[model samples]
Target: MKKYIKIARPDHWIKNFFIMPGVAIAFLLTEHSLKDINIFKLICAFFATCMIASANYVINEWLDAPFDKFHPTKKNRPVVTENMKFSVVIAEYIALIAVGVILSLLVDKLFLITSLVLLFMGFLYNVKPFRTKDIPYFDVLSESVNNMLRLMMGWFVVTDSSLPPSSILIGYWMAGAFLMATKRFAEYRMIGNPEVAGLYRRSFKLYTEKTLLASALFYSLISTFCLGVFLIKYRIEYLLCMPLVFLLFSYYVAMSFDPDSAVQRPEKLFKEKKLMLLVFVIIIAFMILTSVDLNFLHRLTSNSLVWVRLD
Candidate 1:
């Protein structure tokens, strides 16, 4: 049972939390939005995404079983270690695919569409002739698209009224790009030897440390600027969170300098005290800013439905 659980890699599900940000963006605009949410359906949406992502992991592990033997950290993965039976992994993958698809079908049309796109993208990343995972920049770019799909899924899970603001989605995409780039950077640094890194991740063979860092910096700046636009267009007071955001991003960059930094596995943030506190503070500030109806913002932004989009 423990081996089975390990093979599922539930720890990676933390990435599925990306589904909530769009919901948060939409709810912050709606009156009595909390009451309007479908808690049960939202919960299902979360689990469905987790299952879909897990299924993808299964495919990856199965395909990489041979190559994983050469990877330093991945050498101990269940597939490589043979701690879990391949038959069991295949069974779980089938079950996950069924459950994930069925759950998505139970959601609304938009939610279903987003879920399918997420699944399709996941397949492209790991499997087939065009496996983006082995392609240098394309690997990260394809992986980042999952963020937009997750965000859209969340947006539809709560309400089918309309889309979240463009600025919000763009910011989220760039932010994901920033994180992906950082992961590549950490991989390059931690692996130390270029040849070793290539064995673990083929794309690393095409990336220099300088190129990866430059990509990370470029992505973070674009994400920050888009986020700034989002806040300004929605609530000017939200701009106060900028300092915290800057600090958090800086801390993340500093952490990436360490070969074994938790940044590589963002899910490990739960175990990071200082970073978690900073994130907590940021969340609290945003909650307070959005919980109330700020009249001026509605008046300031055009498209009337722009800020809260009450229409």
Candidate 2:
């Protein structure tokens, strides 16, 4: 029983916080006040997301047990260490899916559809014949798409009438990609042996530390560019947060260089007090920017074609 629960990885559900950004963005874009929100529906949306994510984790653990043995830390996971019954694992996965589906029904139609897509993505990532996780860069992009899907789930919970801005969605996806690439880089570094890492993850055979870092750089650059467009188009006030954003990314990159990086275990990242503090500060800043309108920022960024008198 304990093993079954452990395989669900409730602790890792912190990743579902990604959904909050969608909620926030929805509120911001829709100009909704607190009174307008359906709190019960929001709670249902959150739990539905958590349940589906757990289902994904269950399947991920079961399927990756073979490869996880090659991982130093992951070798200790319940699936790899315990003699678990296949039937029980399948039951757990189905149960979680059922719970998620039921909860999603309480939310809007778009949320329900997004949750289903999130579940399907887990199959595409972990199941054979379509396991994009085996493909080098595709692995990163495919996994990161969950970030966008989760965001959409949050957005739809608030309003199903319209989609999120493409610029912000693209930025969020690229940001997730950057984070995923960094995680891979940290894991590759910790493994310290290319052959061993390759055995653990098929994508590693084609990934070098330099290449991974380069990919991370590319992802960050693209994220920044898209996010900049979003801010310029929607809320120029967020431009004030850009410096902190750069600092956050640079700080994360530095953390990946550590011998034991928390990037590999984001669920345990509270151990890095300074990093968590920075994240908190960034969140506060974002919240403030979301509410306040800086009209002067628009004035500053506005294009004013000055007329020069020509002889």
Candidate 3:
């Protein structure tokens, strides 16, 4: 059970929290409501995303084991350490992905499409020839689009009645890219030099601390601009929340300078007490801003959990 769990990399499933913002934002936009039934469906969708993502992680580690053994830290993974058999890993991937597909089908068509896109992109990301992970800027771009797909899945799970604002989706893309670049930056810094980093990730051969830091900063700035646009259109009251986003980005960037920043594995970010508190504050702010004015959004937000009594 433990070996299987290791292959699942359940700890990293935190990355799939990307799915929540979409559902929450979608509910905030036109619906401003979250049905108990919708929450159940959204849980299923979240599970589907996690299963597929974990399958992808297993595949990536399997293929990367050859080089990962050389990494200072990745050497601990089951695949890299050869603690589990290759055939067992393959079986686990199939089972998890199969269940993921079934769950996606339980949602709407758009959800199915998003699941397929994530699966297909996952294949391209770690597989030979089409492996985007080795392509520098394109690597992060491909991964960022997967974040968009996760958002789409969350949106579809609730009200497929309409699409999220373009601004939110664009912001999601930049934020994902920002995270990915920072991860690379952390790995590079942790390894201490390009020559050593390149041994684990081919694209590192083309990167430098300056470029990675610059990219992280640049993408995060774009993320801020896009989110600012979203706030303007959605609920300006949410603008107050923007500073939290900026701070989160900056905090992670600062952490990346450490030899072993939690940024390397996103789940670790929450392990930091202050960062987690800030995230909690952001969630609370969203709840407050959901129906800032009694406009149409307020009407929908009326029955939302924020205002609804459990009784």
Candidate 4:
């Protein structure tokens, strides 16, 4: 019974918190005031995202068991280590999806559709015939799409009638891609053998450490550029948070180089006190930026020339 639960990988649900930024951003942009926001619906949206994510995890674990056997630590996952009933695993997957659908229905139509797309992406990623996870860079891009989907889910929960700014969505997608690429880079480094890593993940067949690092850099650049557009277009105050955001990404990249890096186990990342502290600071900064009117910051975006004299 516990093995069934473990296969669902509830710990990975922390990734669903990606939805929070969407919700917050949507609330800030929408006509709805704070009093108009529905806390119950927000909770429902979050849990719905969790359930669908768990459903995906269940299928992923079951399908990847064979490949995971080649992985050092993943070889011990419940699916790989224990005798699992195929029927039970399928049932669990369906049950989780059902729960997610029910909860999503309570949130909004757009949320429900986005939740279904997230589930479908899991199939596209883990299932045969069309498993994009086997296709090198596509693996990262496909998996990273979940980040944008979660953001959309959060946005719809608050205001299904409107869409988030495309700049922010693009920025969020590239940020997720950057994170996924870094995870791949860390995993490749930890494996330390291309052949072994390739056996564990088909995409690794063509992914050298250098290639992954290069891709990560590319994604980060795109992310920052689009996010910059978002900050400038929506609220110049957010530009203040950009430096800390860059610092956060830089710190994450540095940590990926550590021996047996924590980047490999994102769920365990909370144990990194410094990283968590930085995240907390960034969150506080965002909250402050969102709440206050920093109209003066717009002057920085103006084309006005400043008078200067060289001494």
All candidates' lDDT scores? 0.83, 0.92, 0.83, 0.92
The sequence of per-residue lDDT tens digits that candidate 2 reaches over residues 97-191 is 99999999999888999999999999999999999999999999999999999999989878888999999899999999999999999999999
Error of 4 at 242 (Å): 1.1
Identify the superior model by TM-score, candidate 2 or candidate 3: 2
User: Of 3 and 4, which scores higher on TM-score?
Assistant: 4
**TM-score of every candidate:** 0.89, 0.95, 0.89, 0.95
Model 4 gets an lDDT of 0.92
Clashing pairs in 4: none
Off by over 4 Å in 2: 291-295, 304-311
Candidate 4 worst ten-residue window by lDDT = 302-311
Clashes of 2: 0
The alpha-carbon lDDT assigned to residue 219 of candidate 2 equals 98
Model 2 Cα RMSD, 1 decimal: 2.2
Per-residue CA lDDT of model 1 for 170-280, tens digit only, reads 888888888899988987887788987888788988999999999888888988999999898778778878889989888888889986888777778678898889999
Tens-digit lDDT string for candidate 4 (182-224): 9999999999999999999999999999999999999999999
